[model samples]
Every structure is written in C-alpha cells, then in structure tokens.
Target: MSIKVFLKRVLIITMIILIIISALYIFQDKQRFTKKTGTINFSTKTEEKNILVNKNGEWENFFVKGVNLGASKPGYFPNEYGVTKEDYLRWFNLIAEMNANTIRVYTILKPEFYEALYEFNKDRENPLYIIHGMWVNDNSIEETMNAYDDRIIKNMKRDITSLIDVVHGNAYIPQNSTHASGKYKYDISQYVLGFILGIEWEGYFVYGTDLFNEEITSYDGEYLKLEEGTPFEAFLAQVGDYAVEYESEKYEEQRIIAFANWPPTDPLIQPYEPEDYNDIAQIDVDKIKGTEKFETGMFASYHIYPNYPNFLNMEPEYTEFIDDEGKNNSYRAYLKKINNHHEIPVIVTEFGVPSSRGIAHFDSTRGFDQGNLSENEQAEIIPELYEDIVKENMAGAIVFSWQDEWFKTSWNTNDLIDTERTAYWLDEQTNEQFYGLLSFDTGEEHVKSYPDGNFSEWENSKAIINDDEAKLYMDSDESYIYFKLNIKDLDLENDSVYIPIDVTPNSGAYKSSLFGLEFDRGVDFIIEIKGKENSRVYIHDYYDYLRYRAKSLPSIQKFTEERTKDMDNFNYIYQYLMENVDIYIKETKQKLIKDEQIFESGKLIYGNGNPNSDEYNSLADFFIVGDEIEIRIPWQLLNFYDPSKQKVAGDYCVEGLNPKPIRISKIYSGINVKRGEELVYSSNLQSYSWKEWNTPSYHERLKPAYYSVQKMFEDE
Candidate 1:
C-alpha cells in the first residue's frame, strides 16, 4: 500500500465521521419528538357563516362561530383574587395568539376603583370603554344591605357613559324594584354571586327557553305530595304554589328595575306595567318610573346562571325530570320560551363546576371530581353544554371566570400572586380552573367539550417544551428584526432605527435577544418592536374589538333557541381579538400594499377557515378569520375603522387584572412600512419605555410633553 493512497483514504473516512456526528446532533435537537394532537382535517367551502337580521327581525344564521367574555371578572387589581395589568395583558396577548375574538365587558360605573385605574391607564390618545349595564345583580340588594349605605352602588353608577353599554344581571327573577322602580331592572348582576356565579354555570340553557319558568307536568302524575285529593289535583295545587312563589320572588328583582334608570331616555323599563297585571300576587306592579335617564346604553338586559340546582330548585320536579328527549333537548325547549317572551338579548353570563380540589360557588361541597371525573371528561362536558345555547341564537354568553389558580380560592396564605386561598385560586367552587379553554395553571391542552370534541390546541409552533426545558425557534420569510425585550436586567444598548435581527424562512436562523424563560416583572417582559418581525409572547389581547366586532349580526330569523348559548371557540376568539386589536392595529397601516408578503406567503386564510388547505401558512390566522372575509384585514378595520375614534373605541378593552383604563388607539396605531406588518405602540399606559424606545433626550433629562407625534410614534 502506498503512502499517498493510505492518506487519501484516511481523510475520506474522517469526513464521513464528521458528517454522521453533525446529523446526529441536529436530529437530537430539532424536535425529533414533535407530537401535536394531530390536527383537525375537516374543511368547509363557504368562507363565512354569519348571523344577520332578516326581514322579520329574526336572527339569520348560517352557522358561523364567535366568542363573548362572560363580562363578570371582579374589578379589583393588585388586590386578592386577581391579576395585574401585565398578567392580564399577557392573557389577552395569548388570546390573540390563539386566534379568537369578542369580549363581553361590563359597562358598569365604579368611580372609586376607577381613580387608580385612570391614573395608571387612562389617556386621551389612549381610550377606555364604559359598558352601561351590569352583567349581573349590582351586589344583590341583600349583599348591598349587608355591605354599606348603598353609596358604593350609586358611585359605581359612574362607570357608565351613555354609549353602547348593555346591562347583565342574574337575580332570581331578573328584577330590581328598589333601584329601577316597580318594574323589572335587568341591569344589575347578582350582588354576590349566587348559585349561578358561585357555582358551576348553568349548563343546560337554550335561547328563548324559559330557563326558570318551565311549566312542568310529571308523567308519573305525582305533584304536590301536599294536600289530599288525587295526583292530578295535587299537581294543580303545586303549579299554583310555584306560580305564586315565582311571582313574589320576581317582584324583588323588579324593584331594582324600578330604581335604576332604564330604556336609555325612558324613565323605566316597564313604564306601563298593566294596571291589572300590577296586582298579580307577589309582583309589585304599581310603582311608576324611577330614574328617567339611562346614562348607560343599557336598554333591557337579563342573565341566567345555568347548572345543577338553580333550575332544580325552581321546579323541584326537575330533579328527576327527563323528557322522552335527552337533557339537551328538554332543557333547551324551556330556554327557548324564556328568550322568546323576554324579547331581549340575554346572556348566560355565568356558569361553571368545581373539582374536589377546589370549591366553585355552585357546590361548596363539590368533591374531587378532579379525582372522580377525568379532566378530559370535564373538558368535554363544558363545550357541549355551552355550545348548545349558542346554537339557540340568543344574544351572547360569558363563562364565569376567575384566574386559573386563585380563581375559586387561594391555596397559599402569604403573597397575593402565590395563593390557592385567593379568590383567583381554583377550587371545587371554580372546578379547579377548567373554566378557560387553556388551563393557565397546568398549561396543558384540553379539548372543548362538544361537537368538534376532537378540537386541538393551537401551538406557538416554534416553541417546543421538551422535558423540563423549552426550545424555541423563530422564522420569517421576509425581513430582519431588531427585537428588544424591555427588561431592566439585560445589557441592551441598540437604539437604532434600522432593525438588525436577521429573519429567514427557517426557524433556527435567529436567536433570542432578551429575557429568559421565566420572567418576574412586567417592565422586564415587554417585547419592544423595530425588527422586520420578532419573537412574540403568547399573549391573549382581548380588548380590541370585543364590543362591536359584529362580524355577523344574524337576522332575527337566524336566531332561534338552538342558535346561541355557551359557545367556547367563538367566545375565546372574540375576547382575544378585542383585547389585542389595539396591539395589532398599532402596527397595521392604512397604506395598502400589493402583497402582504409574510401573511400571504404564510398562505394565511382570514375568512371562515377550512381545516383542509393543501399548502398554507398560519393555522391561527386561517381558523379565526372574519366570516365575510376570505383573507382578513385586521379586526380594527373589519369591526371599526382604519384608525378612527370608533375603531379605537371598538378595540379598547380593560380587564380587572389592571383595573386601569385601556387606551386602544393613542398608544398603538401605525403601519410597519418595511414588512407590510402592523406594530402596536403603547408607550403611555404605565411605563417609561417611551423614552427608551424613542430615545427622546428630554425623556431622561426633562418631562415628556403632554402630547406629541414624536412621543406617540416613538413607542413603536
């Protein structure tokens, strides 16, 4: 063997060895164990399924999906049982990242709480929404009597701004005689969460069904078990008893109505309570109009808390009542009646169950169903029960929600953020935090409990949580990004206008420029903009178009009892979109482009999404598209306007997490010229990032001028 031959062979062998080693390393770290809950492969041809008002004033629905935040998160922040603005902002960011819309925010006035909120979050350029009505009883009169001189309630009325606010209430009879006069006032939510808010939300509700007033006749012919006579006579007496009892119970509710200003300018809701109907038993029919002004936009609002006993107690026979039809059937039939008679939009604003680990308001003793029923079962049951109502075509519904861990109760005794004992803590009372589509505590994926029971979780595809550690990858086919996380710790010194972060179609090309996996502060976690596109936190921004994203105002004909109830997917998206529209629109520009390269290249679909698209980009964008739009424009444009007051107001949202006001437009409104993407600018809300992002000399040396384009545009 010659020396030359041997050397050549040795070099070749070494090269092969190096190649094999490289392949092995890449395979090991490149998500070799990628496992998704598969994916929903179904597809629909129609781009939209919207609800419109038909000629007859009926809701015309072709079967489109949407969402509504139950609108009853307690309004206390930096206190017990709540999240801070940053956390709430994160949640809203997550909602948007998840691709959802709509938010059922309360329109009640709470001036005391507002002062702190206004100082921290309010601004002329930024905006806030003032919902006129309460989603439930305004501290039920009972709770009010026990709490104070009713000064708080009156002061709370200041939360309203004679705009498009709708009241939400869940009293036994949907009446508030004291505040609203002798008529029924459906504006206030239960003063203290009752069986509905306190416990699992009423699950079996259908639009227009008389949820509480179902007239039942038992086949067993067993009725009173009270007076003498046959079962028939006894049943009749029982019916009268129920009718009379219900009449009186409802009267108290009417008192609130009598006391509260109703029908906008009209003095009261039931101004003309018939002279004869006034004397009907327990109901107070004689009281004339109370406050003649509805400073809030609330006209007629009623709420029903569905689940377990609230229903059973009203009609004890319901305990064992089963029609030839199943639970969904018998239950919805009665619900339809309620909606039809009320002739107003009613939200199933509160509903939920509890796990043994926690106690939801519904059943204080509800055991460890977390022990008994599998998480899968609980998850499955939720969507079905709620979706059924959405199918009924009622106005909207919000799930009774509390933070994931401290939701039901607090577990720890010390810190506000770390506790199961806090109101946000999960307990049987809140069914241990299964209330949200995504579990905040476990961060595990669970399927919505109904028809599309096979639904899967939307992944931030680039982030792979392998074992205890997470490996993230980012990709963009278009431009470079100069991402800057506004953390105080990191040594970040790039104050250039030109984005420096490189963006490629491949996810591994770029690296993280700031913060670690777990962050402990709000100021430390903000993702600053300037690059073509950068790393995105899974935030659930739900303030933006939550109130007026009426993408599909189904015709009255389309709204049947079977057309609207507890719709999980839609509600999630709606709230998510509402919160983040401001963020999204902040960067979206009015300067239209020939091709929105990234979004289009990603092959994102913005209309009614088809589960089956041969080759495409964003699953998130495709799934939550506006029904009418095949490829969507940002919701700010679709729901409101390009960047008008109405548009910003429509997108403006504020969660109790911050308790501070939310300013949608002034903070974030601009078009990303280079990549044709949008950037949200929020330098004024509650931070000093404006100086950092803008590099204004006076920012550190002098006070920032009240309002300047430089100050405004610098945040982005």
Candidate 2:
C-alpha cells in the first residue's frame, strides 16, 4: 500500500474514535440531567414504631414537620375553596421555604392545588410531601344519628373512591357547590405520604351509633377487619379497608392509612373529665387489623390541643407528670400516654395555640390557653409543643393550620355574631380564626391603619369631628373601625374621654348616667378612656349580649329581668357564667341551685398595633400618643352582626331573644371630654358611612410564628 493511502486510513480511524467518545459523553450528561430533574419516586410506610420513607432508593425515618393547609381565605368558607392556583403555588413556596417537608390537607381541594403542587415539585430536588384527607359528611351523621346509616356509608364510600382517583390524577369530578370539582390531571400519588380518613367524630354521634347498632360489632373486609370492636369501629374498619383495596387494586399502589380522631373521642377513660368529653364511645384502632395485602401498614392520627376538655387540668397523672425538661408539662404527659397506648405510629394531626384577643379556654399549668396570646407568645409555644411531641417518640407533629381563617367561629362568640358574614371580616377576638402561622391583614398591601401611635395613615382620612377643641378622624377596614382623636390639650391622667356609638336604631340609650353625658342619637355602645390602663368598652343594658343570653334562658329568669324597649344606662360588658351552688333555706332544706356569675369582658389593652414594630401586639385595642389617641374596635364588639352587609343587632325582646338583623347605612358617633365631675367638651353626632363590600381586601403575611417553626424544623 502507498504511504498516503495508509495515512488517510489512520486519520479516518482516529475521527471515528473521537466521535464515539463524544457520543458517550453526551449520553451520560443527558442521563445525569434527567436524574437531577426527574420525578422523585418516594414511598412512605409505617415500620414497627416509626414512619419510614424510601426516597433515593434508601429508607430513612421521616419526621413530618408538617402544617395543616386549610382551603379558606379571608372572604370564603372551606367548602367554597376560594384559593386560586397562584395562591397555592405561593403558599407551597412559602411552606417549603419555612423548611416544612409535608403539608396535611383535610378534604379534597380544588384541582388547582394538585396542579400547583405538581408544577412546584416537577424540578425540585427535595419536594413537599402531602397527606391527603377525606372529610366525612358531618351533617349526614348528625341527621341520621348513625355512622353505619345507608346514606352515610354510601356517601363515605363514594368520597373514598373519588379521593383515591384524585391522588392518582385520573378522575374528572363534576361541579359541586360544596366540594371541589374539576379535571384532575396532576398525578401526585407518588408524593403523597398517606391518607387521613375522616373528620373529628362528634362524641354523641359515635355513642348513638354504638348504642343503636350493638349487633354490628365486627366488620370483616379484604384488606382490613375489626374484631371485638364497637359498631363505629366496624364502620371505620370498613372505610379503611375500602381505601386500601381501591388504591391497591385500581392503581397498584399502597401507602400509609390512618383514621382521624381527637382527645374528646379517644378510647381512654378520663374519670375527671366532663360528661360531654368523657369517652362516650370507644373507637379502638387497635381492633382494626390489617391483612398481609396491606403492605404499607396503618397508623393512628389525632387532633390534640393542649387546653381543652378540662381533664388535662384536673387529671392527676397529667397534672403531676414531668417532661424531659423536668417541668410539670401536662401536654407532654398526655402525649406520652397516647404514644404508650398506640402500638402503631402515632401522629398529632393538629396542635398549636392561637394568637387571639378573646380567650375561650385556660390552661393553668402550662399557660397554653386557647386564645389571648401575643404573636411572639404563640411563636414560642408552637416549638415547645413540637418538642413535646418529638420527645414523646411519636411519628410527627402537624401544626393546626398554615394560615388564619376568617370564617371560623368559636363556641363562646359564635352566637353573638352572624355566621353567614364571618368570611367577610377578620375577627381577632375569635380564637378559631387566629390559629395560623400566616395572617391575612385587612388591606391589599398592609393594614389600612395600625394603632401604633403613628398618625401618618390618618392624613387622607376625613375628620368626623373638626371642632375647636378636638379633631376626630375615622377610617375602617375589614378588621377594625379606626378612630384618631387629636385633642388640643390632651391629658391621659386627668381628662376622661367618652365616645358613644349608635350602631342600631332599635335598642340604645340617649343618656348614659354612668358617664354623666347624653348623645344626640341612641348609643348602643360606649368607649370610656380614663387613662392608658383604664380604658374599656361598655354596652347599653338593653343591648348587652350577656344580658340577653341570661334573659333567654328560662332557668335563669329570676337572675335576669325582662328586656324592655326603654333605653337603659350603659354598663360594662360582662361574660355570662353558670355554676352549681349549694343553697340552704332556714338550715332545714338543701338544694343545688345553678347560680350565674359575671366577668368583665370588655376591657381594652393599649399597645403598638403596627406589624413592623418590635412591640407589636395583635390584641392592642388603642394607642395614645403625645396629643393624639388612636382606637381600633372590632365590628362584633359593637353588636354589628354582619358588617359586610351593614347589618346590626335589632331589638332582641321583640324578636324573641335571637336578635333580628337590622340594616343600617351609617353609624352615628359623638365624643365628649370630662374633667373631674364637670363635662368640659362635647361634639355633635357624626355619621360615618362606608360602601358595603361582599369581597374583602386582604394581604398574606407570615407571622413571627412561621420563622420560629421554620427554625425548629430546620434544626431537626
């Protein structure tokens, strides 16, 4: 062969080798990219006593570090599901940013939620896991008084099937008024940690079901069965079996399963508990045995709050128990009991304190009351609660909520306000509405006015009382009706300020003998400011809610007088309380009489309401500056039943105690100043009217609690 021909052949061979090496390099790079950005196929299962997640081809013990995501915003109910895709995306980012690995949602939400979750996790290295829930029809259970009622069972089964399909992302649910409906194309089953089966069962419903269906003691199913269990337990077993069977058979997938329960309906007997909170019916999850086909296994779920049922306070074991920190921690003691009782992994689905002004329940030992806690205090207590859960050797702890819900109502204040209009406004006084780490303030960007002694926000506001002595500016948002009074010569020590507000036309007083002043319009509520520490709100006797409640109860008729149409003197608003008292007549006859007591509930606190301030207090009612005073009053405190529709309270006597809704376009308010005994200055009645809004304006803000929780989760 010639030298040139041999050289050409060598060059060709070298070019072929280079092309092959480059092709191999390109293929390996493509594989690496796909592995980096591909869907993470994770599997979660319960081991002997812990929840283990197999991600990245290795199983590791997983602590949830989760938050409960509710489906309501500021202006909608949970059933309405007013959250949008953008909202879900933003919130998911926030949750992830907060270092929360999981989010547990109760009930199937709109398709946007799944879509957002899928899109968010598409390219993420570590994605947020989900614990999807299926809510039971509470109304049906109450109406039928049986958990195994035909209608209830059928509906529950249908919901189970629907939720299974939703997680697998192959279901098309039709439009419905109550539940979320749409084409669910996002297959997020891989990221789902587990399923929580039902809502917190009412004690009475469980009792009734067990009592009536005593014959139906055990349920046998393909995947799960109940032996020597109550009728309600059988129903739960059936539900769990159906969930396991459908998910396994239809999609060839199995994950962790749990039934939702709470402290009130726990199987344990609290002898010192109230009759209502006592174990009305036992739902023993231990009786429900899983078959070999149920590979993932089952766990126990509960919604436990620290302060409730009164048993935690009264029970000797919990009260005297000491925690790892060597403190008498009742919460940790209760959690230890629960953990010791359950053989399977236990998860506290709901646990957290609320940053609310009005307190519903008290915890004397730990001070983790239901409400009346500042944001910082709430933040501090959440991590402490989580620590207790972790120290108890439980599966995980999911906080009660991620954001504050406006539609929630508490037992103490629900009757005083209209339930229909709860979504339209923010009620800081309602404990249920303030249980979230995120808050929705009453403005598009920030609060309209912060009672932080800063008068800059009041510059654009119109002055209602522009007199020689004082100028009063009034403004309102979804949260509060704000008032700024600039007195020419202000004295927090000597002079007393009285502001009489007329919210309703039916019942009020023109003359308040208590304040020694009269108003042009019938004043239903009065604000008396003696000093920074001695300021409070008072209601006219005819319009007092506590008085109305007392008068409405037939047994307490002797303690309360008949409601008259006549305008009465203003009095401090009181909280009605009833207690059993022993009475003896002439030392011969003994009787147990239910006596009523009064507690002052209208006392106001003064602090900086500004969110930016280091001394910010969410419960701050008023602030006094050098020569100015800023006051914020919740709409419910003034007996405005539905401020969204401008509806106030009507005459309760004529309306049979349940006050009729009275609509008013404007509120008439007047201010007066008193020095010693003589009235120094008085202003004419000023009418403040605003356009009614069915949709409220609000902005999402992460409370300080979010960072506190984030730090705890990150450390873990």
Q: TM-score for all predictions?
A: 0.30, 0.89
Each model's lDDT:
0.24, 0.82
Local lDDT at 223 for model 2: 87
Candidate 1 Cα lDDT to native: 0.24
Q: What CA RMSD would candidate 1 show?
A: 31.8
Tens digit of lDDT per residue, candidate 1, span 1-716? 99999999999999999999999876763332232333211111111122222223333432211222322232222222133444444444433333322223332222222232333333323222122223323345334321112342233332121111112221122223222211112332211111111111111211111222234212121211222332222222333223222322332211111111111111122222222122111111111111222111111223333332222212323234443334423234434544454432334444333222222122112221221233333444445435545656654434333233323322211211223222222222123333434333211232111111122222333221122211211211000111111212212123211111111111111111232111112111122222223322111122222122323322222323332221111211111111001111112332221211110111122222121232322112212111110112121112212121111122122222222222232221111111222211112111111111111011001001111111221221
The TM-score measured for candidate 2 stands at 0.89
